[model samples]
Target chain A: MILAATPGTATLLVELGVILVGLALLGRVAARFGLPSIPLYLVAGLVVGEGGVVELVTARTFIESGAQIGVILLLLLLGLEYTGEELTDALRDHAPAGGVDLALNFTPGLLLGLVLGWDVRAALLLGGITYISSSGIIAKLLADLGNTGNRETPVVLAILVAEDLFMALYLPLMAGLLIGGDALDIGLEVTAAIVAVVTALGLAVRYGDRISQVVFVRSDENLILSLLGLALLVAGIAEHLQASAAVGAFLVGIALNGPAEHAARTVLSPLRDLFAAMFFAFFGLQINPTDLPPVLAIAVALALVTAATKLATGWWSARQVGIDPPGRLRAGATLIARGEFSIVIAGIAVAEGIEDDIGPLAAAYVLILAVGGPLIARAVEPLTRRFSQLGRPARPRRTPTARGTTVS
Target chain B: MTEINETKLPGVGTLHDFESQSGGRIGVIAHHADRREVVIYDSADPDRVSEGVTLTAEEARTLADLLGGTSVTKRLDDLRQEISGLAIDWLPISSNSPYVGKTIGETELRTRTGVSVVALVRGDQPLPAPGPDDELRAGDTAVVVGTAEGIDAATELLTARAR
Candidate 1:
């Protein structure tokens, strides 16, 4: 009966179906290779996007927004991993390491931006893009590699939480700096964003348990719809307030606890999986494949330099926690991947007409690392063990044995 | 060996489809909080759930323990401590309790109750050999090694208000 509708509607349905089917096939292929599906999804988007083999005639707008939702969901899920108190504890314990992370990993891109002779604002944008790690990619990598319980993981996560805290601050400041004129306007915008973030976080910490109870319903459908609606509403409000929508979603996550948190995670995973793939693909869609080739060399060079810096940050952070050398290396290797946030930064820059080359450059850089990071993380374990054997004895060794027998 | 495939059900559980050695596919949906559902699938169409049953958290743990061994579940393992004379229990430090932000030593658990704080599970990280100075954060599960009477005393000591 629905097929009896207009040709335009039919076309829309057909395209959506085709894209989802394509993504599923690519995901299966990614499984075969034992690599992350993100790279494959990106390639799929490249093939189907503008300038690729088949340029889609319709549904770009819908896919684009879905991609935004994907980013919000990614950050939200990451926040659900810990309580506000734990985050606060981590902030206190790992503040110095977080500083180390920002200095080492963030400096390269800032320098590169200056070298490229972009404005101070653009350089800062690039630096922000480079500084934050992709929580989504790291989560997938941990699950795939079965490295969740590794001794270095807590250190890695601590660093990530610190990064998230920084991101909440940096994103608003960047947006303000990018948009406003003069010092006072910039200060006002940044201060307002920070206040909004703090208020949201405080409210979440205080009333989260109550909010979670109110949201949960006996029926599965109601619970899913309610959580989704709540996330969107909060994200929309945060966006309007000139803060990060993702930070808003993340706060919502931090507010929920115990059974509700687990329930939400279970309910949200499928939607997250679907939207997140599109988010990756949508990023690829924005890039011109032809433009990427020229910037490819520079992008790879940036990735190589930053990868090492990220590894250094990880190694330093993990070593500070007294994890053995091998675990330290693994920590460093895992942080190498950069995904959605970098692309988001580049997308904003392109939208604001900050710099023309950055969009393509960021695309190439992300592509290189998103694929390379996991590969290096997986390959590093044996290599590190071998090298550690050659070197002097380090701290007491801790081996990762999975804590529980999970059927799924 | 049990062959398992899974479909994650939103707000409900992860429905794991296990292929039995008899070539039958049975499904078990492990709920996030405290419930696990078992459903029989049709032999012809493994996707079609034929019959269903549900178990509470304790019931599920007991079932797993019965089928496998004592160490089948983490909570159960914590319940049935491997220590010979030293009984262990992962006592949750309740929120709003006075012990929420004090250290093991400050709580004076060992001195007052002769209980050794063996480990502390904060979120998922198990800090084995938690030191005297390790600050007890909210929601921490303190693994205490002591006799039954000593454990009751230690629990009282930790939750007791400052004099």
Candidate 2:
């Protein structure tokens, strides 16, 4: 039956369906191997994108839009995860650690970018990509490895909180700087952005209960719709103000509190998972498969150096909190993975057309780290145990609770 | 009651830990996703957890019930011995309770059921010797003092929906 083709609709549906199924398969593969699914998604994009086995023309626009939403949802969820109290506490106790983390981890990427002759703005973007560890991957890793309850785990989490809060300020400033114009225009845009973000954050912290009450609806569907609508509207407004849409969405997330925040996460996580997949794939699609190989050496070098820096950051922070060497190692190893946010940064750079090689290099760099990070985390404990015997006698196992330490 | 240290774990959830009678440090992590993890700290290194067991939401509830049920009964027994014939009861205010959002004076609890709400526990704050004008909110635990029959009647009257 030679029925008329339904213009672009049929092809779009087929392409979308095939892509989703492929992603699901890749997700399962990732789960089976105990690795984060991000690398797999990126690899899928590389293969199906330009200069690969297949090209997606009809679905390109859809994926691009989904990618944008994906970035918004990722930041939004991150904001929802922590309270203002947690952020303040993390900042109070771990400001020094945060500084160290920034200096050690961000320097590698920025230095690499400068060495490669990229402009300062593009180099800053690269610095951001390398600085932030993947909270999603680290959280999952902690839970998977039964390290969530470990003493050093909290140290890692606090550092992540510090990084996340920093992003709220950093994103807008970078976005403003990259918005090419005279210094005054850039300064005005950045100031407006910071003011907006700070005001929103203040409102969220002080009056979140009232805000949550206003947003709360009886039905989950209505609640989610309202949340999604608010996020998009705020993001659009922020984008108009030259403050990144993702940061706007993040502020909206912070504003929501109490039961509404909890319910919102339940309903929104699936949608986030769906859209975030598209975002990673879309990042891969922008990089021609051929571009990846040319950047592989640089990516590998960056990954190795950054991994060590992350380890040092974690080790130093954990030691400050009195955690043992092994625990510190665990913290460092877990912090090595850089996934969604790195891609988000790179995606922004690519859109700005700051550097042609930025997309491919970022994709390759993230891929190596994302895959290698968890493996190294898992290996660290055993490796430490093995190596420690050479330096000192093996520790004797102590009786459970023998210290007579009173309850605090 | 044992003193417990509560730590807020940024993105994870709350961690409540206490040293046991046996001198072992133990903690429970209540995850945002409703999962719970019971962990025992390493004796050699207090910073590390030597053992950890994850529990589903239902499993955690069950464990709490198993541990708490006996203490609840034992406390009631101690209360009974201290005041013979008179009884003290704690009644939770569920969201659907008729008394919710009403003041104690509005409930006319003492006049109707001969039971006095001696205290109200809202969240972590304990309002001792609540006045008649004190409001009754959902999720409050009212500590009522009366005879057994009167307390039972007050519990029913307070919990039942209005026609």
Candidate 3:
């Protein structure tokens, strides 16, 4: 039995097993502190990656492929989260807020990229990295804090939805731009990418019911198999057409609804989580630890500036919806974290060789915000109360009455 | 009736809230995954919840039943302890089902399937001991009690688009 096995099989199995167990432990540590697991996963990758510590030979291939699938699954599930109606409604109701968000957040990273003397393509990619907040982290934070029912939670969610919808357009355009060519070639490619996205969105809106019907099956196993198969197929075709595969997976997610969407979410969630972990870790693995020190200051400065801008955007939007001061603060604090999507932007740029510094900068930037955002959100309320007391005499804190229950 | 306001939480679910006559704010978050939470907002700050309580799917059902009226139908939990192989299920009426516009009497549900329709929920209202002439509409949920097999048979009959 031992001789029949491949030469390096035991080593491969052992390395993969060790890495996965490490990730599981890191996940538990994050959970203990009520924090998002993403930053820790990235840190784990950094520790084991090149220039840090031990390196894997065989597992590297698995991590690379797993990361690609992870990106696809991430975008697909993000798309699945919103219905067409929600997207349109959010765009209409909060378009101004979305505009403000883009302006406030995108400019900082763009400027940072330009100041560093990077190319326009790389600068634009940085702008995108700064623009999108992590809906995944924020949603989990709100639920954990019991703030889902808060008045300003919808405002926060609406902003997130608008950003995601915008990404549906931005990603394809970036995909085209990333493929270098002459001016005319780039223009044509970009147009084609935009057209593909538009056509996909239109089909999702018009024929989504039919698409869902085609994908849905009684058996959970078959349902996942078909959904996964369809996503990979569309992603492949889109990639072939110079449209980003992520956009195609996203469009696939947008097209599913009704019972099919529900079942798909149920089955795909765990699979998405596993692959997504690999994706983040792989991102961390790409950056050399030594490259991090030079860019760490810049990353810290960029995170601070963007966090402030996110606060302002959230506050303004909440005010537009007539939310009070405390609610506005909650809304602002909620949007401060930049997570998966930011890394995704940097990952694209890194893969395309946009700039050497981008990978380290983005990894450090995301790590700070991902860890700090939640702490800031938790602290905002107490800080405000403290400041209020300092300005005036302290009033007796009112104990919440349990008498709110209705007997009728 | 208090005016209930509904807000859509983009990636989460829907939130429906209302202010009580005493000026207290109460809300429910209905998650897409069938999870439910009851939240009471802080009187001092409407932006925060003073208390939040999560409910299991069954607990949510019981809460709805209690709010609507005293549920005369046997509680599933109580019945489970008393008998083996007995079941109670809440089955939804889909719009495409053939029985959507038909009266409860027309299906001959109890006579044919041995499953009794104990209560029917329409909109936010619960109808306990619905009469034979009561009409079944799309989106209404019917509570039925019987053996496990009978419930399955009844579910098929109610959900099937064709006889």
* Candidate 3 stretches greater than 4 Å from native: A1-3, A384-408, B69-163
Which candidate, 1 or 2, would have the higher TM-score against the true structure? 2
lDDT tens string, model 2, A311-333? 99999999998877877888899
lDDT of 1: 0.78
Docking class of 3: acceptable
Scored against the true structure, residue B18 in model 2 reaches a CA lDDT of 92
Give per-residue lDDT, candidate 2, residue B126: 92
**Clashing pairs in model 2, backbone N/Cα/C closer than 3 A:** A401-B24
Clashes of 3: 0
* Per-model lDDT: 0.78, 0.88, 0.88
DockQ ranking from best to worst?
Answer: 3, 2, 1
Among all windows of 10 consecutive residues in model 1 chain A, the one with the lowest summed lDDT is A142-151
- Candidate 1 lDDT over residue span A1-408, tens digit each: 765878887777788889899999988987787767777888877787879888877767778888989978877876776677767877887888899999998899999999999988889888977887877678677646645434466667778888887877787777778777889988999899989888888888889889888887767788889888999999889888888787788888888877778888889989999998888788778767888788889988999999999999998988897876777888899998887777667767766788877877887888888889888988986686576556655544446658885535
**Per-residue lDDT over A1-408 for candidate 3, one digit per residue giving the tens place of the 0 to 100 score:** 777758588777887898899999999999999999999989988887888688777887899899999999999998898777888888888899999999999999999899999998899999999999998999899988888999988889999988888888888888888887898998999999899899889889778899998889999999999999999999999889888888899999988988889999999999999999999989988888899999999999999999999999999999999987777888999999999999988999989987999999999999999999998998997765454346445546656667876544
In model 3, residue pairs whose N, Cα or C atoms come closer than 3 Å (at least 3 residues apart or on different chains), thus clashing, are none
Runs of candidate 2 exceeding 4 Å displacement: A1-5, A385-408, B1-3, B21-23, B69-163
- Fraction of the real A/B interface contacts present in each candidate? 0.02, 0.62, 0.75
Q: List-wise, what DockQ does each model earn?
A: 0.04, 0.34, 0.36
Give each candidate's interface RMSD in Å: 16.5, 2.6, 2.9
Looking at model 2, residue A285 earns an lDDT score of 85
RMSD (Å) per prediction: 14.2, 9.0, 11.2
Instruction: For residue A382, give model 2's deviation from the true position in Å.
Output: 2.1
